[model samples]
Target: MKKLLSFCLGILFTSTLVAGEVGSDCTFKGKKLSGKVQFVTSFPDFKVQIVDSFPDLKVQKVNSFPSDCGKWQEVTSFPDFKVQIVTSFPDIKVKYVDSFPGVP
Candidate 1:
């Protein structure tokens, strides 16, 4: 009985850890990380931090064709998603690259 309980607890812990991981698919917390993005000071859909290495997503800023994952187009009026640049406590960490933008 004790061994069974330990096994169940271990499974639960592993699942919990996996649930918080962000994949290369560019989706986090059910929010898709593509399309036109707006930078805002407040009331953002996601808060992100720019990093030099070990990023959750590799981002490429584009003028058009933000349809693919990790591609973002900056817009003011109509945005598919809004993000706030934060120094700390970001929802995800990203690295801006010139090419090959996607989950890494």
Candidate 2:
């Protein structure tokens, strides 16, 4: 019985240690634009996607990084929106892009 209990505790601790965390300070502030931007996890890397939004919704990406995330961007704009960060941070890095380029 004791052995089983110890095993369960070990598993619980290990699982908690492997949990993922996302970092982003996005307030998703906008009138016609109301969307939040943040990271999901930094396991392998980040991902990107571009889809149509509501009317006049300006999805402007600022290319941001969490203060605790330890990401840096001397210059913005990456290759595939999934920019790989070069920092030793526990959290992931992120940046902003005008996902919503406003109306024409």
Candidate 3:
């Protein structure tokens, strides 16, 4: 009985550890600039998608190491539509979001 209990506990602990590991890809979906640009467990801090409108610039989240998210011009004006950068993820393609507005 003790062995079975210990095995169950070990499995539970292992699953919890894996669940705590941060993911490498995901996007945000909601109004831009409405909430803090913070990391959520389900979403990758390194990538996000603004649903209501496009942010003028996109930034990537780095995990304690230097990252090359690239230089993005700060978004001073918010658009009125949702946007997703289909060509890239986890890295900031500076001009990618800008192309969203011109999509025909």
Question: lDDT of all the models against the reference?
Answer: 0.85, 0.32, 0.33
lDDT of 1 by residue, 20-91 (tens): 345656798787889999999999987888989878888999999899899999999789889899887677
Inter-residue clash pairs, candidate 1: none
Candidate 2, superposed: residue stretches over 4 Å from native: 20-104
As a whole number from 0 to 100, the lDDT of residue 89 in candidate 3 is: 40
lDDT at residue 89 of model 2 (Cα atoms): 29
lDDT of 3 at 75: 30
Task: Give model 1's clash tally.
Answer: 0
Q: Which portions of model 3 show Cα errors greater than 4 Å?
A: 20-36, 39-104
**Pairs clashing within candidate 2:** 59-99, 59-100, 60-98, 61-96, 61-97, 61-98, 62-96, 63-95, 63-96, 64-95
Worst 10 residues of 3 by lDDT: 19-28
User: 1 or 2, which is superior by lDDT?
Assistant: 1
- lDDT, model 1, position 38: 96
Top candidate on TM-score is: 1
Best by lDDT: 1
lDDT (Cα, tens digit) per residue for candidate 2, span 10-50: 99877644312231332112111222233333432343233
TM value for model 2: 0.24
